[model samples]
Target: MPHHPAPEETLPVIALNGPTASGKSTLAVDVALHLAAHGQPAEIVNADSMLVYRGMDIGTAKPTQAERRGVRHHLVDVLDVTEVATVADFQDRARTAIADCRRRGVVPVLVGGSALYQRAILDVFEFPGTDAAVRARWEARLADEGPEALHAELARRSPAAGAEILPGNGRRLVRALEVIDLTGSHAATLPAWTYAIPGVRAWGLELPRDVMDARIAERVDAMWEAGFVDEVRRLEAAGLRRGRTAAVAIGYAQVLRFLAGEITQDEARADTVRRTKRFARRQLGWFRRDDRIAWLAAGDPGAAATIAHDALGPDALTTDAPQQRCGGGEQAHGQRR
Candidate 1:
């Protein structure tokens, strides 16, 4: 297979985004290999927030080195466990990586579950400036009243932000409230879903609700079997508890509780499964809102080929005008409705 045209010659990015356990990583490698065979060499640029941290291999479901099939990957294992991952920081780094890949005459396949991070890279979105005092106040309130109380307060102030943020996600909840306090609103004031970067299109991997739930359960079970707790223990020694963002990753949070003896192993397992399913559902909801994404069923054998066709075929993948809202044309390709 010949390498696809250079970035200037064609689309610069093919984003493979989906919920956890949707096989995006495998599909990304498959797409890259397929592209390379066609002479369109491609590399993977991770967009997952947690995957940026090193020593977070198993629980984050990070692809193994062998699984990469010798394809170059960017943005994985770049941060120590003590570092914080911010969307703005990620946007700068990921965009730079994508550009670097293009300069090297390779396609940059951006893949991950973080909707906002993906958007920050591809959309004309800017984060609100944060005030130290405002953030501190909200952080202190979170410590005092707990996440549930603060989330309720946030719901009262900004219903949209509240609905979008998980109650247990104290960090994000705090940030949302902080944004609200600083900007007088959250999310509403930001730019609508519009691709700021040219030559990019997102393909979403989806499965039936039952299939997705099963995948989540199965993945959680495999995580335990793969010694996810042991992985967490190693990361804790690397100062995971001090790492604001990495410490709260789904499995890490649960395992931390288990390590602290706050919960039994069985309880941790059960909670991890339940929280993962809920997180997956939330992920679907977030991705579903972006009409620009072309959905493809995860179970379809032809899904990867369809994605390749969409990216490399004659049809020009277009985005709506920046001023236009994204509320239409969200049809899933290569799957039954």
Candidate 2:
């Protein structure tokens, strides 16, 4: 019997993205295992924003070293909780990891729920430069006047930026206003930013809202059982406070409320579920707006792996394969509204 040829292989930078509690991590791990079984081991790169911060484990749902199952994972737990990590930083780090994987003949698998981080890694988005003094000024204003007032000011200065920014998203709102103050140009008209890196095929996962909510609740319970409260307490003991990005993370924030005695354990659990659901919704909304993401259903990991393999092909496993170049390539992949 003549053997059928495998699908024409192309070197792939597989980006597996989805909303919170959408099983992206598990799916990616399964896909990596499948590829390894097929003699093409994948290097899993972390793309979730909160996962980048060190000392944030249980709440972030970071995969344990054992769970990695010998697959090489990169770009996770690389930054201090106090240090700020922008999308540009993620793009740079992820590109380096992908390039390194390619050099070593490993498939690059970008996996996580952070839509902006995923887009920054795979697509072009120019982030305006920041001035510490200006940022400090804005931070002061944010502290003094609150997010609502700052949002109102942003609406007046750059409605385009304001419209895209959620009122509660203080980090982005401050960045947008700071850009306007520094560059004298609207945040929307900045030059396109591209990662000086090769291309990769990206895939995203989609789950039903109700199903995702249920999963979030279950995951929150698991976290609590796994000592998520102690994890938050440890961070607090180490002087990590609310209003910081790490503290704002879904499970962490809810736990902090519980620690403060502002909410009961039941309320904390319920709030974690609610906040995670909202975050997941935002992530879905962000990724769904991008057409380049080949959306896969939240089903069997094997099925997801099959879809990813079918999309990326065997060529993606080849080392230093010549990448196909295209114009507006950066814009073509991750243009989320």
Candidate 3:
């Protein structure tokens, strides 16, 4: 009901958002370490969508346990691949993590490059509730008339919403239409719902287009070498299919095609590279449209940490001296297990 405090009004939840393979994870780790060295320890919360799915480690670029570097991390490997984890779900989880961190007197450092997921956690966006009948009708139409025709219809009915929903994202398009049809309001015009817990600031990481492309290519090659193909095979063996959300993760999908004999390894690698580049472009476009984020150019993790510390203040990091938890008392990472 009430509005959440703006960035300047709160304790400071630092966010590091960027495209995939732009070094957000490594940067986040470095930032956390810097905070620790300053006697202000920070906890890393995963904002990546795919990383939340269990068994998606390699392709998702999930930080290795050792790479976590004694810093507390939350929200990774929290979901089953078969389970549907929506933005709303992530909002609730991330909000809880932020609150818990702040309560403990530790700064919550949100990290990852999943634009939609990150925005869902940091900003106020209301996802339209689903209606089975409406969804079935739209899906049937989507199947019969195809995505282009359905996109056209959406454009006719809700131009603003259509502008945001890509034709290829059938689920989102249908959801938008459902919102308009059910609520008699355009999805794009939906009011921001307050998820604001005090003390949150979002930062965006950016890199030159050429550099980002090269990084993407290199990451893809590393993934392949790190048993990415076997990861896809394991998912398939677990009964995951191509059209499923988990299977559609950029690298996973392309690698799956290769393993299935649908494309050569070279073609798959090239396709993955191209898709990753396109995804990065979309990420930049999405973040650029939002004015709230404080942008930092990629490279030199220490510089990013310094910028975050400056923007958020020295208190944003929790020092080892004595820290509090969200509800009360000190809560250490891995204390639950």
Candidate 4:
């Protein structure tokens, strides 16, 4: 039997995003149920870059099966510790999941702290193809001239990209320069906040700075108690150190340093808290740049339902739910918004 695509009106996607520990997962489940009550069957597609790695449960704060509460989830635990997850790779898979859900007449809710990954999936952005030799050349330049000089060159070539990326961030600087070399301009290589995916609505959860800081501290302490160190030890034995992307995940990196005896466990935990707070701020900064996402307070219990209902419209609960489809197109780079 040939599968027909669902009507556009019936397919609405809800993207619930926020900083780490801002309760996006829990809120996503709640919103799914709320939509289900309106006859909208929904599934969650994972967007957090770190959560895709299998065996990275506690540290990544991956939702437990029980926590999922019968709602189907996609993209979680889909990668091994040794595999690298690029934004383009994630965007491809996430779009597939969203399309499949719509074909089945189900709503797709994307939930995560990775604003770039989410944008890559939801926005009309395309990553440029890479040339390994060119990349290597820039990397070599980075090594010899240091990031400052390379960053200065990038600033001269593409000031917009340079302003957005910190000079100390060599990898991004290299990628920006690479894109500029490939396309004559770097700013055009990044995604605009415009939506390419129809009927896609995004919401951001907000909390006071102090509250988020305290939450991060508490969460780090809980992870320590939940045996995050032990989890990393097991993954380390499974070649985690060689996984370019996985090795540098927030908690895992701190734990790896602790294991190397470079830092005490207490220092590692403290550093994790510090780094996480900074990361959360960065997440906020990235999402804030996009004007489309509606912001809601983190403490509000009804916020998810409100956002979901708004995205689906008043008729959503009473009418047969329609499915939404996500389409991909070519264009640009997509981190930090």
Comparing 1 with 2 on lDDT, the higher-scoring candidate is 1
Q: Give the alpha-carbon lDDT of every model.
A: 0.81, 0.73, 0.72, 0.81
Off-target runs (Cα >4 Å) in candidate 3 are 1-10, 140-156, 184-195, 311-337
After superposition, candidate 4 runs with Cα above 4 Å error: 1-5, 138-174, 316-337
For residues 1-337, what per-residue lDDT tens digits would candidate 3 score against the true structure?
9998543345567777878777788878787777776676588998887888888988887889898888888998787677766668888998888887776767788997766777777767667666889878987997798778888888999887777666655656666777778887775434453434444555667788999999989998998899888888888887656334676678777777798899998998888888788878887887777655656667743444454455345375343322221111112111311
Of the two candidates 2 and 4, the one with more favorable TM-score, higher being better, is: 4
lDDT of 2 at 85: 74
How does each model score on TM-score?
0.89, 0.82, 0.81, 0.84
TM value for model 3: 0.81
CA RMSD of each candidate after superposition? 6.5, 7.5, 8.1, 6.7
Which digits, one per residue and each the tens of the lDDT, describe model 2 over residues 144-221? Answer: 988889999999988876766667677777888888999886654333444333555666777788898888888888
Q: Candidate 2, overall lDDT?
A: 0.73
The prediction achieving the highest TM-score against the true structure is 1
Superpose all Cα atoms of candidate 2 onto the true structure and report the RMSD in Å to 1 decimal.
7.5
Residue pairs in clash, model 4:
10-322, 10-323, 11-322, 11-323, 11-324, 126-332, 189-333
Span of 10 residues, lowest total lDDT, candidate 3? 325-334
310 Cα displacement, candidate 2 (Å): 2.4
